[model samples]
Target: MEKSIHKDQVERFGSILLEIGSLLMSYGANSMRIRVTLNRIAKAFGYNLELLITHRALMLHIDDKDDQHSFNQLKRTSPHGVNFRLVSGISNMSWRIVSEKWSLDEIEKEIERLKSLPHYPRIIILLLVSLADLSFCRLFGGGMIEMSIAFGATFVGLFVRQEAVKKTFNPYICIFFASLASSLISGLAVKFNLGDHPEYAFATSVLYLIPGVPLVNSFSDIIDGNIMNGIVRGMHGMVIVLSIALGLALSLLIYQI
Candidate 1:
């Protein structure tokens, strides 16, 4: 009966650890950070954890110090996205679990709450992203006309992306469409010679589609010796860039530029 109880406890820990690891993976946490966070939580529970992180899945092996209880699990992560809020929330929760010696139930509740946290409204995001792109236009030596074109193009493109995401389209497909939409709008400046730097407007309009998070995380993973995960992330970022290029190429073809 004691052994049964021990096994059950270990299994529960395994389930929670899988949940935590998968959440971190999906939200753009690097492998090192995820492994460290899991280790911290396991140490607080009087167990040790070994985690294997890949681009699409996580493998976990956890065993209590006594060696009497052990659990192994493999859980596939969801599609990756950038959510620094959730990543930081999970990191902080791990520290709390360690310092406060939180029970499994408490940790689980906190994870649920973090997952429920709402993002900024869509309209706010669209406006801010458009404004940022417009600023980039000016920073790149564009005049007011170029900035205006970039702003309008970015707004429309981002709106298309948001709507595509809502309908659950493939992420790369969404990016392609967004880029195409933005380029088509900004290309007008070049076609009509509306600005002194119409090329700057055309170029900066799709800058918002750059996969900055994945590219940064890829380098971090590589520097931390997670070569496989790093390569996969790097390839993923490159694919996104390729999608952007294809969209831009189609726009050039259409405008015969």
Candidate 2:
């Protein structure tokens, strides 16, 4: 009975650790940090977990010689909600893994299973905010005055109508507003000769869209030995930077035309 209880406790702890790790991954955490946090969580629960995180899935290997028994027991005891949440979190982190590593059918099924969870709303909101921020930055050439006003507006939108914005404000609307405001500000600056570098105002405004911070974080994650996560994040940062450059070039071309 004592042995059974110990096993159950370990399995429950493992489930929570995996859930947390998955959440962190979705938030762009490096693998090393994820591993360390998992270990810490395991230690707190008086268990030692041998874990591996790939771009596809997280594998938990128990070190005990009787691990097979523990594994089977865990398989039987694991809550469907916990498993569903873990898979959903992984899928959220990287959609590329869906069809290739974890079956698309299975992920979809799990997503359906876990649709009632509270964290789902938070995850959806975060994704929406990130998309909106990216679109806003892309549309505005980094405009100074307009970007400032938009930032304030966005903050107010987030604060006052947090739930409504979370539900309704998709990426395109944010981009449209940002672009309209930026164009107005840029036109005014150009017309009035308000500052020495009117173009610089636009450039400064769109700085929020720059991927420099993500690039730096990716480099740091790699240097710290989270190579897989570093590579993933670094690629995303590079793409964002390229996108910003492309947008700027197009804006310049349009101005000339």
> RMSD for each model, in Å, please?
0.9, 11.5
Q: How many residue pairs clash in each candidate?
A: 0, 5
Give me the candidate number with maximum TM-score.
1
lDDT of each: 0.93, 0.50
User: Which pairs of residues collide in candidate 2?
Assistant: 142-202, 142-205, 142-206, 143-202, 143-205
Model 2 residue runs over 4 Å out of place are 1-7, 55-57, 63-69, 72-194
lDDT of 2 by residue, 1-257 (tens): 88887666556545555555555555455567677665654444344577766543566754334453343112221111113354445445334332245333453454445444455465465445544643464464544454444344333333333443355654333333343344344444544655455554445433444555457758978898878768976886776656545544555555652
Per-candidate TM equals: 0.98, 0.53
Prediction 1 TM-score vs. true: 0.98
* Candidate 1, poorest ten consecutive residues by summed lDDT: 78-87
| Candidate 1: residue 74 Cα off by (Å) | 0.6
